[model samples]
Target: MSLTSVEALTQVRARTLALVAHLDDADLERQVDPLMSPLVWDLAHIAAYEDLWLVHRYAGEALLHPDLAARYDAFETPRSVRGEIELLDAPGAREYLRDVRDRTLQAINGRGPDGVLHEMVARHELQHTETMRQAMRLGGLLAPGEPHLDPLTGPDGWLDVPAGAFAMGAPDGAFSYDNERPRHDVEVGAFRIARRPVTNGTWLSFTEGGGYQRREWWSDEGWAWKEDYDITHCPDAEAGHPDAPVCHVSWFEADAFARWSGGRLPTEAEWERAATWSQGTDPLQAVGQVWEWTSSWFGGYPGFVAHPYREYSEVFFGRSYRVLRGGSWATDSRLATTTFRNWDLPQRRQIFAGVRLAADPEVN
Candidate 1:
């Protein structure tokens, strides 16, 4: 049990608790949004998940709440039904967290090489903290971030990533998701990429430029989704944060913006190249503010194999999902590495996501 794990576990708990400190029992139990789970659900889910992995799986012990495991399993209990199900109340949930943490610390001392699993578990809690914040923000329980008094701006010019190949995924040195495994090299062509994610004010330019009305700027499916949802303004733009990165945007919205601006979204490969380039004259700015949508679909790299479990990555490899690069403000630092891949359906926007523009170099 390294001190690092202990610190991470303790620190993340404090952060999660602080995020919900202002909310009462009803706020924690409320569904908030159809797309998000109740805050209480997220709290108990974190504890149950940690106990499953650390206390039972790693420590070779019985689960503290064996009967409750099914209730917290994310896949088994989808977000839509979490609020309707029997779950621990806010007080019980908090008690569950403390009980689970006590056992996890014991596992740290009485254990196998628990560091990797600890990292995975800690990151899981970190991620759900963000998920809880999503619910809080939707329900008006969480306060907005610092206001952007002026329009958002970044480095004045786009970066030129010259054609080259580089290692494109996580290496064996640290803890990474199975999807980021087996680091490999890949080629990318010369392209121009924005130094910062598109801001709320800038995205307004697209919306007011008839981006939604102009069918030419959107794909057939994107257009259908736009029309179906009666979509109009970007969420952050409507929220009065003009200088912040435009958030809560779906992939369809991002692609339409890219097309309207005569630019394109970067493939995950191009995104990684720009983010990881060593001889770079400049680096992308304000990356962690929002999860930048990528043009790439979610899939495995060459010779990709599932580790720990197949459900984490293997089940979602298909065109049904678009890959997102860069981490959002809600993303944990440990899970925000350049190689980390976040994916969702093209039309989903509940998560904190934004866009960065890219384009091919002009052929002369």
Candidate 2:
């Protein structure tokens, strides 16, 4: 059953808090890497985001912590400097979350609330929860526990998608980011996509066979990044399984692996078409396990218009960022809808990401 807007918001808030429940002051405050903020900062930032959307934008109310806006605003303060900023203490951040949620509840219950905005805010928190987990995983703060991956699934090989036309992107009135808007028809040639994502075992084969040393397999920029970072393996390789879809694989790594495996990364449209088909007889497995890199760059749909704020999606539409589909283990299941566009630097391997290969129908 679909949750009431209030229920969804409440549940997302609960999950956000639960994610950080055991972490104490020091852990929450520590910045594990420059790419991510301190966990406590994330907590406050979540609160601040809710306050911005719910209390300020939706409710048209006075700011609760207006003074802290400069500090907590994501664009105003980038991740590189977040660790140095003096943010609310862990307990204080929790209190801020509660306070913001209290106001959010009032806003949603008072008048006919814009359920779409409520959903957007709820999903925003959900995304942040995943971000917080990324920080936890990287910081070695998470306790030893079972991974979310399942054993190998689906048919042993490829799923063929015939040459055809299909409507791409989410339709109007749906709950999706602006990047997924302006649904349009697209034509693609016949291709075969993997039944399952490329697993750690497959990736390990590449690395063991000197995949990193073989410069020919990597793009010029990709090889440069590999050598610059001295990156040799995924972050948690010791804990990974041959069956589990690889995590922490960057677009560069995914591309190189695809080349080594005699395939290529699927374009965003192909990925979407396959995902749409996955719903029926043409089943695709191991989705929502890790964000799958696509061969497409992050760009606006043809008729894209920035809704509410340009900062959300418009700012990042460009060649510098590569598109990723699916959702990671830490992702809230609801947010992994087919058209939800995710983008990051091609060289960023810190986020939980994996690869899926595609090739011409005749190749296999």
Candidate 3:
């Protein structure tokens, strides 16, 4: 017999709950500034979101609490402050989560599988998993306790990609955000991108050699961000190490570094082309090492049509955010698809972000 939605939900819930096992209340409550949420709030929000989107919205179930709808329906009103999640207090939180999961599964079992709903919930849950890891990192917890490759593995030993143009975005019926919509053709010229992301060792060279201090290395905006933040290299910056992937730098920062090194950041088209270079036959996804910052701004294509997930992308267009290709170690494998794109403001840095180098074919 096939596993029921309830059973799957149980499994997902178990995994989410397990993430908190190693975390104390302090860790759970800790906030990584304004960009991220407290783990306590994050966990509760995930449960509430599953209930709201899958169970109630798609499955046609009643809300557990009528008044709770507004709080849970945060796609319209994205939370800025990590509100106190009194509803998620220890025993009550677990019980509430179980209730939501069980009820949602029961509905799913009777209604059967809804492909769109399933995909959305799956993606949403995957996002939460990444948020959990970001929270862990913010809480100073990143030891895997087992084997996992470092973030900055360059594409040095990997297969070389031939020059070609490939279909970049989602086709029909794919659960893609609006930013990836109106699936368009992008011509990718021959180029060479590092197989893996840039290592901390490489990034440090630029920084230590006056990378941030030099005006020539920075763009107008990049220079402002540096000067405004009074940016200075930490002699003990963790990202300054050789093996670590360069983290904590903005897209502009990475771009400046790339510019300083006589290269340029990859465009969205180029990044996608490099990522899906071997799309049909390749088994290994090029994501999950780190969140690769692309030089592309988050914007709609020529004939873009907004979908239900429009807010996920279009709302932030022409704003401070930029396009980031590839998921990170903190990202869920489901969300780690080659086509998946993550975005944040240029100045914001909290997650496991790292830079990768791409060069023009002629330059290489």
Candidate 4:
């Protein structure tokens, strides 16, 4: 039998709690950069979302602890402050996450999955997972250590996929955000995509090679951002490390680099096909390696409809944000679904963002 609702949630919560345990108090509240959040804020935000969705929204119950509501408001959008979010002590926050998860499971058990709250909790967790990954990257938590292929490691070789028509989007029974609605079919010609994302070493080569200085390599808009930001980094403009996933770049930046290298960003169709339609029995599932920026916009699929999470995708459907596929190392493993979509402004890169090359090999 498949895992029960409570069992599934419990397991995921346990894993997330462990991931948070790795950071010290100083790391938890460090926000030296504007693009990243204090890790303490992450903890508080997850608990607050759980309380909002599971307890109040779903069960018609009050918040687990009523006094914490004000703290939630300050966390919705990214902040530039660089100090302790004093309300969220490390030891206390972990205990709160556990209590919230356990009580949510109890509520689910009592309700027998009859209400909408179960699915809401699941979706909320997915968002937190993505945010957590970004925080980890900013904190320098992903320092090279393991053999595991993180977003920062490009595979030594390529993974070639044969041409075929693969079903895309979320199927029924699995709760998906509105953005993943109107499941459709598209043909994907055989193509080779990097098994991992572009690494720091490789990206550094582009910078050292005057990839940024040469207008020939940049698109018109990309050149504008380069000039506007005054990014003359033959040595160090200090955006991020050579080994860290390159964040805070515009689509134009990614596009220019891809073009200079004889490749281009993957279209949304190509990206989803690669991610959701993997070969063999294992379905495409790469949640916490890297957040891949796709050529697709955040617009709805063919037959889109709004859902309860109104702002989830609707607010940023246009060119304001580019589409990002896959979750990053800081992401919660359980929060990701093949159909999940995350987006951010093209120029903002304080997250676990990176790119992998995709192109027509015959032409190359």
Compose the digit string of candidate 4's lDDT tens values, residues 242-264: 55555445566677778878888
Report RMSD (Å) for each prediction in the order shown.
1.9, 1.6, 3.5, 4.7
Residue range 64-113, candidate 2, lDDT tens digits? 99999989999999999999878898889989988988888888778656
Local distance difference test, candidate 2: 0.86
Select the stronger candidate by lDDT from 2 and 4. Answer: 2
Error of 4 at 356 (Å): 2.6
| TM accuracy, model 1 | 0.95
Alpha carbon lDDT of residue 188, candidate 4? Answer: 84
Model 3, position 139: C-alpha lDDT score: 56
Expressed as tens digits, the lDDT of each residue in 1-364 for candidate 3 is: 1344455556666777777777666666666555666666666677777787777888888877666555555563355745443435545456667787777778777887676566666667667867767656665664455114364433353334566767878777656666666777777677667666666677777877988888998889878987998876633244345675666667777888888877777787887776666555342234576788888878878887766666666777786778887877666665676677788777766656767777766543
Identify the runs in model 3 with alpha carbons over 4 angstroms from their true place.
Answer: 1-8, 30-32, 75-79, 83-87, 141-164, 173-175, 234-241, 279-286
Over the full model, what C-alpha lDDT does candidate 3 score relative to the true structure?
0.68
Model 1 residue runs over 4 Å out of place are 1-3, 144-154
User: Model-by-model lDDT, in order?
Assistant: 0.85, 0.86, 0.68, 0.67
Give the top-scoring candidate (TM-score): 2
- Give every collision pair in model 1: none
lDDT of 2 at 295: 99
Q: Flag the better candidate by lDDT, 1 or 2.
A: 2
TM-score versus the correct structure, for each prediction:
0.95, 0.96, 0.86, 0.77
